[model samples]
Target: MRNDIQIDKRSIGINFIDGKASVRIWSPDSKSLEVKLENKSIPLTKDDFGFWTITTTNIQPGDLYKLVINNEQEFPDPASVSQPEGVHGRSAAVDVSSFNWTDQSWNNLPLADYILYELHTGTFTPEGTFEAMVSKLDYLKELGVNAIEIMPVAQFPGSRNWGYDGVFPFAVQDSYGGPEGLKKLVDACHAKGIAVVLDVVYNHMGPEGNYLGAFGPYFTSKYNTPWGNAINFDDAHCDGVRSYFIENVLMWFRDFHIDALRMDAVHAIKDFSPVHILREIKLHVNELSQHTGRQHHLIVELDLNDTRFINPLEEQGFGMDGQWIDEFHHALRVTATGESTGYYSDFSGIADLAKSYKDAYVFDGQYSHHRQKFFGIKAEKNPGQQFVVFSQNHDQVGNRMLGERTSELVSYEMQKLLAGAVLASPYLPMLFMGEEYSEPNRFMYFVSHTDKELAEAVRKGRKEEFAAFHAEGEAPDPVSEETFNNSKLQWNLVKEGQHKTMFNFYQQLIQLRKEQPALKHLNRQHLKVSFDEAAKTLLLHRWHEDQHVVCLMNFSQQEQKIQAPTEASNWRKLLASHEPQWLGKTEAPETFEAGEEILLQPESIVIYQNS
Candidate 1:
């Protein structure tokens, strides 16, 4: 019957056309389906494609409705745009063309210029709403971040979540000011010349509050994910499921005016099909971007260390714009802290940092002690701009036993040094929320599942996961309200003593990176990195055309002398982390000559510009 039907690919959801409503839902399992609205049941005719359709003037914008399957079971529409009363409640019909948008001149920024700041909508501000985030746009703009990567905001179980448990793919989170509030936030961000990148999960849906399985076979037990069952991408009757998610992505770009999307944990997306779902998503987004005349970019979060995600489509690869590179973070963390445990065991010395700086990935086709196998392919030819590097992110911090940040593990001087390395690297850099001022709050994992058994299981499972850390006392309960409350950033600390000084240091680094041609070049060919094993020091040489800069960093506890190149030349002191103005006790040096010995303070970094 499906083979004999001719279904419009674009007519899979509720649509408003010329003062009339057309409703469409695909549910092969349901023997009968009806649209329930205004305490009235309107029968829908089933098509050969297993999709029920109804054309009527009864449904209007702002109408709350549900789909009744098998003439007995009622569930919220899976394609709902707004779930005002939680995920399990009735869905509200929305007319996306009604919103007033002022970002007509805005375009997606290039990957080379991205200075991403990742934040969670619920924990970013005290108010924990999109309206609250709008007030902080000026603050983020002043922080010199050109892009804000908001964690997933799709509708989840209840009022509070990290958003990865979202079940309604199309519905905006009700607690975070809903759909209208999100549009306002996007409009404000574009007005400030700041791009917004939203995190989206496609590998699996949440266990609770999902009615998708009741409608059709949207998931497969054939494969397993760490979270749950994987989405049915290559399984039987998977076409409608694929279209559902692909259209969801299109809705974000075309309807919400989102500039880019960051796909979460793409390595978990298992597709044995000849054409992967990732490629389909890329092609569809590309087509939508051309028709809408808007620049839309796709970024994937993968630890596979595969360069094919960033490769062009014509090269038999998924055409993604960029990807998150964890090797850079691991190398930098091990080099600074000298902690070799868990995944950090694979990297131990400062040479690892140099390797990452040179090739973008340090574990390229190498034996990994942590993984106990040869891991990752070589990506030496990829542009550094395509790799998004960060010293701290939600996963790096929250996945730990105590949810402690790098600032908590290292000294003040090391924090400055780490910031310098990340900001100065040729790769695009991202900062976790509240990382600028070293906000002391912990970003612990928290959720509010309505199911009692599921909540207790999450708490018990988290304790077992961190048993190897040997952390003091017990782990925090992830389903507790206190855990979520404690994770909100302490915004008042930014103006206090050392916090203000550290914030100022980040501002200077960002300003210099943007103003200097050599820093913005972001080309690995123009960058050279070398480190001293015995001295515990690293040096980077970056140049573009005639402008050049040399960075000297000392990770040792004692002061060490580093050398400049042998070529006779004059250099001026541009910036130094040890300067008294940056809350360091050392006095500032004026200049240095080629072949000169420069003394670096303990755990400090200094930058010199060729004059």
Candidate 2:
């Protein structure tokens, strides 16, 4: 008794009825196109433009289907909105509107007030499940982090990875719980006033189980990246490829109520189109924000040092909200460890630190011997919060020959100094997981790949890659299960002496950032940094209105006496690493002689506030 729909041969299109689904695909090169249903096959009629259309009344949501192009079978639509299973498996038809959202009062937090905490879900807890992470929401709240930026959670080959190698862009990783688990996690976070920022990888898919090529021309050989052939963002049929990614980004915000997205390795996305992919993504995100009445933000990770990424689209730029300030971290690392190999070759001494603190870009318009070309541009006036600075992050720790943290390589006094420098800088500060407590464990690179040959190759390559650093001992085999186990955070360490000291230090620094009006100033013009290169000491002065604060760091091993700047005459000791008050000892200085010679402990940093 149901009406049979007749298709017009002149046009190709799809109409989703109450109980039936229609599909249309365009492939001029294919001799034939067929719809492979779960129980039957329907031949699609091709129009003059080589487009195929087919409709079936029996097909409904949750039914799986595939397309046959020129006798070659492929996965569901390349622009599939949901891959409920995995990438290599069948794609299910999902009704996105069916899921009822519980968050009606959630809104994105202001970027200036955001204190981001970057965490990897797989190793954040022993269970490594989204539900397990929910138990720790109170812990993050207590630490004063407003946003949690999770590493890539897209499905990959196995249970363990950094998630960068994810191939299924739509499917959540099965091991860390799936899409439902992620939704629950986001909802829980919103309930507690925490914003969720997902780290998404678009430059390249993992080597294993990637099937985008079988579905369509999602990649191009015109350009290549370190991972392999780059995504075909500018080639023919690229419109759909770009839409696929843009839709995924929108899905995160619309469905999960995610506030922000941190794009991974944007430098590898090679797009020469007049409207670049990043620009298009930003435009779409802004539109979505307008429609939903909720703010959505996009942060990019670019190593090119181009300010164009953060510039507005109307101003002829990429229009990203901000970028990770790797140069700031590099400067901090080089200053703390005094290691100059590899990328650190461009960074040394207090000059680089001064530039990173005052301008947020140390290599701006300078001839970098590393790239052999001028890198970066001067940030626009009042663009202080456009850069995110940190002393340590996932890449910095995991990429090392041995995953060594700043606490492992440098003394505790130096760790406190680095923390102060990062927190008091003009840019936004990000804290790596367990960095506050100075966790002794290193976060090594680990993957659970079943293929022995590929696993062995990765293990060998990781070891050989570190030969340049002259790292001692054998590199931790990334393929080994022990590698993954070693990276889990040991929460009990917080009770120990050294880790407790660092934890309290981080708490004090965060409190200072909140209370000090000078530290909250985002204007680069209001910042002044001076350093004694010969004495291995640096002083950062920040002022806004009538409030001023001074951050002094001593990098030398022996006690040194240095005269305070003229403005520091009214300085009162607010925090000190060697001060016994921070460590339960009674002997602590309440005040220091102004403009007079003061002795600094080896590798100590002190903060003074004008009374």
Candidate 3:
């Protein structure tokens, strides 16, 4: 039982211990398993737990090998840490302990201090490598985000991928500089006082070059996922499958020193075991922390607003440290852009936005017209920092037919308002790549699959998804090089007009979110959110101890009237979108007192703090 189990560090795949190479694999479905090195194959002894193990000095680092199943078919190790020749090629032996890390005194920041900037490695820069991203860390530090959330880096087919199609769970994307590149990047980030958060897809492996099924029952046929077969977590022989993924989780924290992991699409993870796989992962993380004496976090990206994922393990929940809330983004987007299509149609603008500010889940136990059912449950029991809110993310933008970013879809002033709404919330705020500078680049979905049929299927799926969102024109070819190239961010835009202003505005907002007493602490209980539907305005008031701050936002195209909170007097202006520096059309005063009527500029936000 997990209650009595005191987990310790367990090594999977290839490892070097006591001056010898030890190879381990779990394959119950195979009658015979052999480790095929250059020009030779060695048999491995299988134990009762269905894991094949061998310790020998013959296999060493830098040697390429494959696992021979049933003395015929060959495939890479399921937990290969190095895939030098893409997903279909042989797995290279990697000495995991070789990387020299310098940040020995590095410690993680409090979760409330995390202002995450989510970026895709392939599209973040022109060079599109971990080394290139390292050069931009200083720029990110200046932007005031304390952490960066990198998209999935697990090895995938070919060169280009959103990374959801990864086949090797333990391997770093070779195209993105492999394991060595990632280590350098993480080390550099720690030196800059920045935390690294990696996005990992655990629900399903990509279809192309996926050979895990050949060795063992890694996937189950009883259940289906939107992408492919659901992972075999709760079905027969589930213990091995659970260990496969749980070990993957430990590999990142123990070997790579990743500060946090964002588990992608947990809603699709079909697990019905007595002890859920996610909970087990959390328990293992705790044990790993104890062994390593370091703090690690597991933040899940789930569409379901169930607090069970964030609830404590003692309370019969999965005990994830944090979760991304999309309803907050949907509400703020619908309010600012007036986009009432698809899921946006369900949100009633300011009312839903206000609800999200207070409860984090807007559709809690309410009927959702889009999903066509009662969606979510109340998450008020969870603290504010446990919820991460974002206005633009990879999926929220890239999945579109044209893949237009929020900058292309909304006005300049409205973008400022959206940024304010996210930062002002009591939850941790995340910004999509290039959003800080309002970079005008389409983050289209692209993948370079060796399988022609799979590429065509992806194109068809993208077209159908676009149609569902009522998009016009032909969808961009998902497998085309043009599609991938066009998605690259234009770094030159940061030196230009409104983009520069937007970047400065974001820096101020992020700085204020860190320095302001009321905004710095994420206390949902001390926050009061209210909105006027007729005026299309929302007022958010937050108080921490003796400090009080209020943010008034006008989402309408025309100027709207708003009133300050009655209790707080001598309110001084800290930041406002209506300020001339922020490029607002209408000029506004610097300060407003309690119960004062203020005419806010169209599509703007003003934050006032009591002196």
Candidate 4:
């Protein structure tokens, strides 16, 4: 036996027998650590590193076990991979190698051509299980989505949740059909040529049923988050805590065969170390990717407008593949919906949209009335592909007073314009599930907690949080079964006339993106945007070599026109919101021709290619 390896202090019993199951746990603070299996207690033999081990013939895969620490408090294994019931229940032993994977020849889809679809697993379907979601693979594939970004599936203290309240970082949620179920889903998706990106929350665990502190100093009270104490990533004994999370990231890719991971609210991770946790995670994931011959990606949900997240460290950057650019979404939303409240207050007219499109940041060192301080860095030189743009996402939709979508707030014509702006942009595009079909149902926040007191608090807090919006009626109790049912996608909506039209339009837009080289190029400096601020219209020109594509958007509700600039003469209408009507207006209007109008329908967007 190699005595140089340091054993984990929380391990109970670890025996590396040829056929028998072995378990190990380290409890240096505890006088005794016993493994309880099938109503029998087996005392573990303590080793040098506070580890206790036992090789048991009866212990096998699918067995339920718990560790009695200090002979007083019983807890699940801290390194457990499957919590079959809930975070508070016994950990289920699972043999990852036992599950037969069928995606042997699966290769990850290239990130450059990705159109990510983000979905919440709990309310994505009626059954809300991983097995049940297999039926929807065809639907997503048909929608032209190359990747699926699933919301967090880590074990929390409930049977149903939005997944932000996850406690068990390593274990897959039992309510979502456990570890085997998720593996099956990933394998199925790979076979269908779809990549899977898991959304992980490492900022802080849920309020209840979290036992990380009992084993070691995994949290620190030095800083306070909206939830509570921040994770102890930069404090004493922090290396072990960091290693614990990094290992979890590796486990997902190596065992589950996940293509990528989306780190949730990375700005909240609050690390100030020499080698940041994110950088360390990137290094390990990259190493694993090379060893396994699989492409692994890390996407961060960063609220800060920092370019360092995507820029290379040689250039003094954080080295993330990409980060969610809310500025683009906010700018698009303001132009589409004309709503200016909360964060949307800073976003107003075409100026913000033009700025966001040309340079991925609207608040680039500009004075912000919202933050009462200068915010964001200038990203004028960065490649657009390093940012992910969206019109609607889980945060924008679910955080609403009633979880209403853009379809509910804006006109159909405006939605098409929003679609044009997102699809035609150089940045990678993402869609919330059912957004393409303009589905009427909303995705409300829902959860089912085992503790009644915590459930009541969640319900009350949800209602009070929307008090400023003056929303009608009390907020729906998230714990109610009705909330979950109401959030499900209505498939019948796709067959309806207007919804079907919108869906086809989205499909065409996606196809256009894939077919055009100018649309895929991530270069930002080569693109130029001009807007007639007074007329509520804008023209975006993207050029590579001698080829160029021009996109025009009309933000006004009423029909209006503007004299075309000199470059417009070379333009030909390739795609339009109201196509077949504006086919051949190739000749550019006189540059100095004032009051010379091009007819535009209310809230219509048009795209023109240089022929």
lDDT of each: 0.86, 0.78, 0.89, 0.78
Worst 10 residues of 3 by lDDT: 1-10
Please name the candidate that would achieve the greatest TM-score relative to the true structure.
Answer: 3
Model 2 worst lDDT run, 10 consecutive residues:
1-10
The runs of at least 3 residues in candidate 3 whose Cα sits more than 4 Å from the true structure, single-residue gaps closed, are 1-10
Error of 2 at 265 (Å): 1.3
lDDT of 2 by residue, 1-611 (tens): 00111211111223355556666665545678776768887778776644566677765776676666677766554434345555556666544334556778888788877788999998888888899999999988877787899999878767889999888776677778777788899989989999999999999988877767765677899997887788989998776577667767877787667888999989999999988999988877777777778998889898988888899888888889888989999988887788888788899757799888877888889999978888888775527777888999999999997898887988777888788888888888899999989888999999887678878878888888887777789888898778988999998987688788788778888888878888876767887898877778888888888777877888877777777667655678778877775552223355665676666676777877777
Please, what are the lDDT tens digits per residue for candidate 1 over residues 64-103?
A: 9899999899999898888998888999987755679998
lDDT of 1: 0.86
Off by over 4 Å in 4: 1-28, 42-58, 467-473, 563-569, 579-597
Backbone clashes in model 2, listed as residue pairs: none
Off by over 4 Å in 1: 1-11, 566-568
Candidate 3 lDDT (Cα, whole model)? Answer: 0.89
Model 4 lDDT tens row, 1-611? 12222222212223224566677654545678787877788887777655567777767788888888778888887777788767788888766545688998997887777889998887777788899888899988887888999999988877778899888887888888888999999999999999999999989888778887786678888888877899988987676577678777877788798998899989999789888888877777777777778888888998888887777756767778888889889888877777787778888768898998888888889899988889989875567767889999998998886788888988777888888889888888999988898888988888878789988998888887776556677677788888878998887888688888888888878887877777767678778888877778887778666667777788887767755445534556567785532222233332222223566666777666666
What TM-score does structure 2 among the candidates reach? 0.90
In model 1, the Cα lDDT at residue 367 comes to 93
lDDT score at residue 454, model 3, on the 0-100 scale: 82
| Cα deviation of 522, candidate 3, in Å | 0.5
